[model samples]
Target: MAFYLVTGGAGFIGSHIVEKLVRRKEKVRILDNFSTGKRENIAPFLEKIELIEGDIRDSGTVTKAVKGVDYILHQAALPSVPRSIKDPVTTNEVNVLGTLNILMAAKELGVKKVVYASSSSVYGETPQLPKMEDMQPSPLSPYALSKL
Candidate 1:
């Protein structure tokens, strides 16, 4: 079975991903700090996967989490515009630096793929009704900028 690592696997989206992977009988591993993620989200399949409680900002923890993993589904982030405006440093550290850490670890470990979950807020205040990837990103808040 292909091993999969889902960062922030205890969060809403991440938990759903984990459930799908588990239902497919894939070998799944979860890395979550639980700062914003809730335990109940993954409670249904808690026994089916390996859970690592740690922050992505810590390289050591990230390395440990990525070791021996084949694919990485990166979903960890501090989401909020007002909160990021209040504390941009923490947002950058978690969203940007934490992502860097995951990439570095994935590279060193020879992981096959890394799927990043970015926010639509990166589009900022585009006048267009529908946001397309072709459009240039106009991040307004620190949270959006960090995701970009």
Candidate 2:
């Protein structure tokens, strides 16, 4: 079985990923500070998966979390355009710097892959139904900029 480390695994999207992984009987680990993620989301699977309650910004915590994990599904971030606009510093710290920490840890630990969960808002408001990967990012808010 593949070992997967999902940051923010208690959040909406992350929780779903955790559920699918558990269903498939994969070894899963989660690191979340619960700033935005709710306990109820992950409560059901607490005994099934290993969970580390910590922030991604903390290097020691991230370092400890990354150990022995093969793939990292980087889903942790301060996710809100309006919230980012309100607190750009926090947003950048959590979304950008926090992600950098994860990437650095993953790289140093020799992780096989790191799949980042990027926002479609990076493409801005266009008539396009499906935004292509080649499309240029036109971020309107700090949140969008961080995602870019």
Give the winner by lDDT. Answer: 1
Clashes of each: 0, 0
Clashes of 2: 0
Model 2 lDDT tens row, 11-115? 999999999999999999999999999889999988999999999999899999999999999999999999999899999999999999999999999999999
Cα displacement (Å) at residue 110, model 2: 1.0
Runs of candidate 2 with Cα error greater than 4 angstroms are: none
lDDT score for residue 90 of model 1? 97
Question: What are the lDDT scores of the predictions, listed in order?
Answer: 0.96, 0.94
For model 2, the local distance difference test gives 0.94
Pull out the clashing pairs in model 2: none
The 10-residue segment of model 2 with minimum total lDDT is 121-130
Model 1 lDDT tens row, 95-142:
999999999999999999999998889998878977887778889999
